[model samples]
Target: MAKFAVIGHKGRMGQALATAIEEAGHEFCVGIDLGGDPAPVIGQCDVVVDFSSPDALVGNVKAARSKGVPILIGTTGLEEAHFSAIDEAARDIPILQTGNTSLGITLLSALVKQAAERLGDDWDIEVLEMHHRMKVDAPSGTAKLLGEAAAEGRGVALDDKMDSGRHGQTGARTPGDIGFATLRGGTVAGDHSVIFAGNEERLTLAHSAENRMIFARGAVRAGGWLIGKPPARYTMHDVLDL
Candidate 1:
């Protein structure tokens, strides 16, 4: 059985990951939380799963690389610099980073990409997501993932084409731009919908997370798949083969 180390051991996702690891017949080697250093325990693990804050990402990646352990990062709210760190570390060790770890969301992203490719520019694309009240990031990472998928299908950059935070006097909608709407409330696991609005018909692709276990299960499955793989940056797409 593979030995798994969990970063952010005290958080909601961390606890769920622990249960998932046990359920998957993997050994829980260690759990590092706030103020705990993963560098001390990383060598004992065959794979690492991180659901910690963004601030801890660089250090976590460094620790995993130092031990030559593959890491699966599920932390959201990451900035470009965080990804740069991951990319650098991935050169030495396998690394899989994703906004959402749900298998359903991964499949949804594939569908969103396919839909965006088939639809013409006249169809306006909008992404909507909802999360728990305690989630700090707006637009939820899953929303961004879907938006990125749509942008990929359209052969454009998400950073340039994304239109988020609409407010007063926004004027007319820009053609070919992807819009995002975020909602927060009442312990939601997660909910994401992508809408394609055409002349008269609207098509929506959606996924609703019933519980955190879905993410936990997916993360554990990905961590197992990542073990002994070549050093490279990866995604949930690689795990699902979509």
Candidate 2:
């Protein structure tokens, strides 16, 4: 059985990952938390799954690369610099990074891409997401993933077309723009919906996460899939073979 190391071992996702690894018949090699160094234990692991804060990402990637261990990053709210670090590390070791690890969300992204491609510019696209009250990021990472999928289908940059944080005196909606709405509440696992609004009809695609175990299970599966793979940047789509 594969040995798995979990980063952010004290957080909600980390705890869930621990249970998932055991349930998947894998050995839990180590768990690294805030201020804990992973380099000491990374060599013992077949793969590393990180659900830690953004601040710890660079160090975590470095440790995994040093040990030549593949890593699956489930941490959200990453900035461009974080991606740059991941990209650099990926040159030496396999790396899978995603905002959401749910198998359903991966399929949802593909469907969103297909829908965006088939629909004309006349349809306005909007993404809505809700998360637990403790989640710090706005427009949850899953929402951005869906928006990126839509943008990919439309053959445009999401940054140029993304419209978020609408308030006071915002004029008419821009054509071909993708909008995002976020909601935070008590103990929500997660909920995401993408709406395509046309002249006379509307289509909404949605996914609701019942619990954290779904993500945990997916992460475990991804970690297993990544073992012994070639060094490269990867996504959940690769894990699902989508």
Candidate 3:
């Protein structure tokens, strides 16, 4: 069995992943907290799974690469610079990163892409997501992922078409623009809905996460699959073959 290291061992997702690793019959090599250094024992593990914060991502990737280990990063709130760092690290180690790793969300992304492709521009796409009060990031990462899927299907970049953080005096909904809405509070694990609104009809696709286990299980599965893979950047789509 593969030996895995968790980078956010003290966090919610990290704790869940620890349990999942055991249930999946894998060995947990090390647990690294926010300020903890992973370089000390990262070399002993076959793969590293990080659900920590974005600020810690680059260092974690560097440590994993030092030992030629694959890494699966589930941390969100990442900027473009973080991705560039990931790409640089991937030159020497395999890396898989995603906003959401649940199997259901993976399938939902595909379905969202298909719907965006089949439907005309007359159908305005709006993405909505909600998470627990403890979640720090707005517009939850899953919502952005779904928005990216829709943007990909329409042959447009997400940054160019996204309409988020609407304020006072916002004009009419722009055609072809992808809107986003975010909600926080309560104990909701996660909830995402993509609405395709037309003049006379509406189509909505949604998925709700009941617990953190789904993501933790997916992360463990990805870690297991990443073992012995070539040096490159991968996604959940690659892991699930979507």
Candidate 4:
């Protein structure tokens, strides 16, 4: 029965989350969209759930900090500086954020790590992601996370090895470089596949989000769980108790 505050109520995922909160019989304490801050309305809520834009999210985190409310940020495409801010704030509050909040994504990431480790360095890794038309970022952040797991397992640096979109009949594939391919169209919620190509056979690990609720509901659950803990920064794995 925790009070809930939904930031980014104007967006599709945000609105749907608001409805989900209501339908779940957990009170919707406040909802703020593009108009204004949810501070006034969510004054006494247990936690804040943000599905807002990346630009507006920094301010939202600050507001939540000011209120001493735990925050769950679901916005994507944020730079590391934004995460630093979250880390700074988490000294006195619990702040959980993830590129994609679907529980399955967490499982997928773990499996990717195992695959990368077992496949070893000789295997050429490529990630393919497809999303809906309106998503702004090129390589979905989720893709990068998967790539990071792959790189970590292979004992390499992600920034040093990531290669995005080859063109013009590029020659032989570099053994160490991990490639990422992005596709955008229609109302496709989200799709990601990590393809490992090597001698003999190729293995692909994929996950698809058929509905935004996979993320929204996961965020809501995270918000509810986060408000209880002490100050710290956490990801979906922490929420899922992995």
Candidate 5:
């Protein structure tokens, strides 16, 4: 059985990952929340799973790298600096990170890429996502991931083409722009839809998460697969072999 340390253990995803790890016949080396010291238990773990905040990421990566342990980072709201840190950490330890870990999202991403590739830019793409009210980030990370997928398929950069929000009298919809809409309310685990709007037709691809367990289980499974893996960056697609 493998041993894992769950960062942000008091939060929803961390708690879910803990339950999932135990159900998977694995052991929890430690559960670190805010103000909890994970360094003490970092060495005991065969792997580390981070569902913590962006603020806690660098320190956690440092702790994990010191022990030469593989880490699966599920924390969202990351900036470019955070990814740079992850990339540096990956030089010494295997690091698998994703906006969402659900198997459905992984498959959905692939399908989005294919659809975007086939659809002309004139079709117009938009991504909408909703999450629980407590979630702090807007446009949800999964929305960005989907946007990136659509952008990749279109042979364009998401940053350049993304139309994040519209207020007041925003003029006409920019051609070739990938728009994003966000909603926050209730206890939605997560919901995302990508729309391809053409002149006479529209196609919508979507996924709704009933609960957090799907992501939790996926993260645990990814941690298990990461053991003994060579040091490098990876994703859920790597874990699910998508």
Candidate 6:
């Protein structure tokens, strides 16, 4: 069994992942927190699984790189500089990152891209997502991933045509506009739907996470699958071979 270190072990997803790892008969060697150096245990782990805040991931990435440990980052809300840093470190070690770890979400992304390509400009794409109240990011990372798929289907960059939930007095929906809507309350695990609206009928693709364990299982599976891979950047598609 591959020994792994879980950063943010006290947190929700991290705790669930730790339990899942143990249940799966893998070794969870260390639990790292926001303290100084995680060198005692995390430094020696074969892999580092991160589900911490966006701000803390950079340092964790740096530490993992220094120790020559492969990192799997599930933290969302990363910016340009963070991605740049990840890319820089990925040059030496394998780094796998994904916003959503559930197998269905990644498959949904594949289908969304295909639908976007087929619908072309005739359909208006809108993504709706809902999560728990404690979720830090608006629009949810899964929504953004779906938006990226939609943009790719239309042969456009996500940065160029993203309309983040228009407010009051919004005019007609423009061509090639990918919109996002978010809702957060209670303990809703996760819900996402992509609507492709046309003149006649609308096509909707959705996935609802009934329980949070799916995500934990997926994360652990990813960590186990990527224990000794080559130095390269991998996605959920790569992990699941989709």
Clashes of each: 0, 0, 0, 0, 0, 0
lDDT of 4 by residue, 1-242 (tens): 88988898778988778877776667788888886976666668988888888888878888888888899888888897888889888998889988888889888988888998988677899999999999899899889888988888888899999999689998988878999999999999999999999888899999999998887777777777887899999888897776
- Model 2, 1-242: lDDT tens per residue? 89999999888999999999999999999999999999988898899999999999999999999999999999999999999999999999999999999999999999999999999999999999999899999888899999999999999999999999799999999999999999999999999999999999999999999999999999999999999999999999998888
Q: What TM-score, computed on C-alpha atoms, does each candidate reach?
A: 0.99, 0.99, 0.98, 0.94, 0.97, 0.96
Error of 4 at 176 (Å): 1.8
State which candidate, 1 or 4, has the greater lDDT.
Answer: 1
Clashing pairs in 2: none
Candidate 5, residues 1-242: lDDT per residue as tens digits? 99998999888888898899989999988888887777778888899999989999989998899889899999999999899999999999999999998889988998999999998878989899999999999888899999999999999999999999799999999999999999999999999999999999999999999999999998888899999999999988888786
Q: Which whole-number lDDT from 0 to 100 does residue 135 have in model 5?
A: 91
Please rank every candidate by lDDT, starting with the best: 2, 1, 3, 5, 6, 4
Candidate 6 similarity to native, TM-score: 0.96
Work out how many backbone clashes candidate 5 has. 0
- Preferred candidate (TM-score higher): 5 or 6: 5
Worst 10 residues of 4 by lDDT: 34-43
| lDDT for residue 165 in candidate 2, whole number 0-100 | 73
CA lDDT of 8 in candidate 5?
92
Sliding window of 10 residues with minimal summed lDDT for model 3: 33-42
lDDT of residue 45 for candidate 6: 83
What's the lDDT for candidate 3? 0.93
C-alpha lDDT of candidate 1 relative to the true structure: 0.95
Better of 3 and 4 by lDDT: 3
Stretches of candidate 5 exceeding 4 Å from the true structure: none
Residue by residue across 38-146, what tens digits does model 6's lDDT show?
6556767888899988888888888888888899998999898889989998988899998899999989999999999987597999999999998888888889989
